[model samples]
Target: MVGRGRPPPPPQVARDEGIRPRRRNMEDEENMYGKLKFNMPKFKGEDDAEAYLSWALKVDKIFRIHNYSGAKKVAMASLEFEDYANTWWEQVVTLREEKGDPPIDTWEDMKEEMQARFVPTHYKTDLFNKLQKLKQGTKTVEEFFKEMELTMMRANIQESENQTIARFFNGLNYPIKKIVEFQQYSNMVELVHQASKAERQVNEDIKYSKSKQMIRGGLWTPPPQDRQALLVVQ
Candidate 1:
């Protein structure tokens, strides 16, 4: 014989038994994620797009872990808002009304609308421009490369491994640049490794030069009486 309908939900473990304790443990495991406090940022407008995307990813992860059903996940995520986020929600509603579109009933649709408004073509262009001109200036080599990496991500510039290495190599300071050219580095890792060594050596040389100058104090001139003695010796 087989069951005709779905089984009843498990009860709490009031009297501990193998099945009841297991059921209670399972329930606790399922609900554990609910204890987490989501410190999501409130989106104001286009300028808040990055923060919104980050929060959206966090919410997506949490909802997935808790096994929220499609519509339920969407509904719960929509409700999980800080007070300041209300303004952005209102703006979305107003925009939808102006477009004469049917209400956005799904989180996916809302995300799409948010992207359409915020992640404009010009934003990518600006990121691309920044990446193109990025150089290792007063910033350390590591800091400069990190900025380049971020700009590349924002611009969605998917270069080949070799091309990325080349780009990074080109932006290095003259001394490091000269050394990097002669080395047959396979990828960015090797490039960065060699560049880091070169940069450290250069920095050390500069520090050593400064220390040497400090020891010298001033021009190496004989003292007044030493000058007279030197003249007699000459």
Candidate 2:
């Protein structure tokens, strides 16, 4: 009765303590979702099927979360802009045109067709060959490892932690391989982290060696004429 004299605290403010105003809440939800754009990469067909399928699944999930169920129209629109092979795209277009009113009716059908066309039946063999041929040649340790990871994914190859460590060890360059082997790390993750650090150290040492040499040589060689004259005098 005493607090009733305070005029019931304004209706808007009295509704709830933690609840945001309705319009503001809607705006917040919009802001959260606005950052999510369907930006999956274009499918180039074959050899690129896994990457495209992964991207497609993620985009489809986003649409489902936003209550855009089925999303057939949106999915087809997205596919339209992808860089699928020209002949393949033309074939799909021709089939759709001849089929009837709605062309491909569902995203599921489109996905199935795309998978059949592009996903390799024997990725394991290719993946194995890639892993076998992989080397640290001309690549940094991280780059080589990343390449291996991609190949593993495409191959659907799963290895134990020890196997992973061995796989990576097999591919490492000589000096780094020798050092990492001696360290005897049990976990592949730690092994990779240490390998990256060792790679950085090795690179730094090489760079330092080059810098000292350049400093000793004054960073410039005498021109051909001067070198020839000096050689002749000598």
Candidate 3:
């Protein structure tokens, strides 16, 4: 042939292969943002430290569900700030810029900044005091465990597994603790399960004892001779 043939067109599959992953990522991001639009909670800058802690916990849960990157988490959380909280965040960002400090890009850094700004210095101390005084008392094991876990999270307290197990065990009611102490427990979960089981057993025993008392009080009758003697005395 006298003229050179045109170069063959690039393969369609090759062109699409590069775009497929990018397109998928874009779609995933869209879905994540859509969920966040509805699920994200607004922080109103309440003076109560517990309110701030609860908001942080809820935001953290959503971030975990989406498995967002640090930058994305910070960005998404900041979007939900309202009123005084939003103003505070803006001021903090401006100050960092003026001071030549690096931006808060990570969720941990953002949380630290927020905690410093919004939470009082006495918050952690108060949480610790409350935790130390926590007891199961009339609460169910599950209720007590939830309260303890929430307090630890809010306080940012760290303890060894054994320490956690011991704390949970010691907080249990005497009857449940008495039964659970002799059993082996390597973790808080195991200790709670054992303590819950012991509580159930204690309750069943109390219920059964009451049933027996009812039978004796309501169903049993004195012997005929005893009844006759009592009638004569009367």
Candidate 4:
């Protein structure tokens, strides 16, 4: 009965302790999700299958704790990760709400949380991956050009200017991501117009590959400029 005078000891302490373990459990649950990668298919359902598929997933990290008594609060936080052609550079976006203020936390917590995030991806396009490898200094320019040319020859569509540009873009030292972007353009005009700084070089590189293919295949043709050349691109 003598301890009864202690004023029932603050109940917030007990509540906070109880919440911590549950929050940790939630963190563990999030880790269970792991990570995944998604690759955009080249040419809608061609060369093989006739099925369309999209990759998606979602998770909630509700166990985040909040503290108002000095340095033991968990603010609202959310993080998202996405993948590209290569799993090596998966995308992760994070948003946090903390103590009704901007995110504030210790280095340890930030480091641990960063290390905890999981991101996995794969090489969706072999040629694209090769291009990235060249950009990363992992592959040589010659190697990239070789595979790119082969891919172009194999995936040759329309056998027109667009396909030629795609081939040159694929062979460049630029990363696969940008090359894919160029290839996705609506038409040769858009492609040429929308091309990035790297893409300008692509236009010139295509000339080399175009002539090589012509010689190898014994295919020859003149420029599409005839009597309608009173106005030039210049």
Best by lDDT: 3
lDDT agreement with native, every candidate:
0.73, 0.71, 0.87, 0.40
Residue pairs whose backbone atoms clash in candidate 4: 65-74, 66-73, 66-74, 67-72, 67-73, 67-74, 87-121
Candidate 3: tens digits of C-alpha lDDT, residues 42-161: 998988787888899888777765767899899989999999999999999999999999999999999999899789998889999999999999999999999999899888898998
In candidate 1, where is summed lDDT lowest over 10 consecutive residues?
A: 38-47
Candidates in order, TM-scores: namely: 0.64, 0.57, 0.69, 0.18
- C-alpha lDDT (0 to 100) for residue 56 of candidate 3: 90
Better of 2 and 3 by TM-score: 3
Residue ranges of candidate 1 with Cα displaced over 4 Å = 1-39, 46-49, 57-66, 80-107, 217-234
Model 1 TM-score?
0.64
| Most accurate candidate by TM-score | 3
Residues 1-234 of candidate 2: C-alpha lDDT, one tens digit per residue: 447456555457455555657768988887778676665455555466666567666656655546443555445435644445545767787877888645555567666666677776665687788888888887888888898887887676878877887888888998788667767566877888878878887789877876787689767566699789989999
lDDT of 1 by residue, 6-73 (tens): 68667686555768878988889877877766553444454655666666667666656665566675
Residue 44 lDDT, candidate 4, scale 0-100: 23
lDDT at position 3, candidate 4: 86
Candidate 2, residue 213: the lDDT equals 71
TM-score of model number 3: 0.69
List, residue by residue over 1-234, the lDDT tens digit for candidate 4.
Answer: 538556765545665888999999987766664332323232121222111111111111212222222222212121222232122112222234323444435423532343333211232355345544433234444454455555443333246776656555544455543665635566644543444434445656777877887788746554568324634643
Off by over 4 Å in 4: 1-73, 78-111, 117-218, 221-234
- Model 4, position 100: C-alpha lDDT score: 45
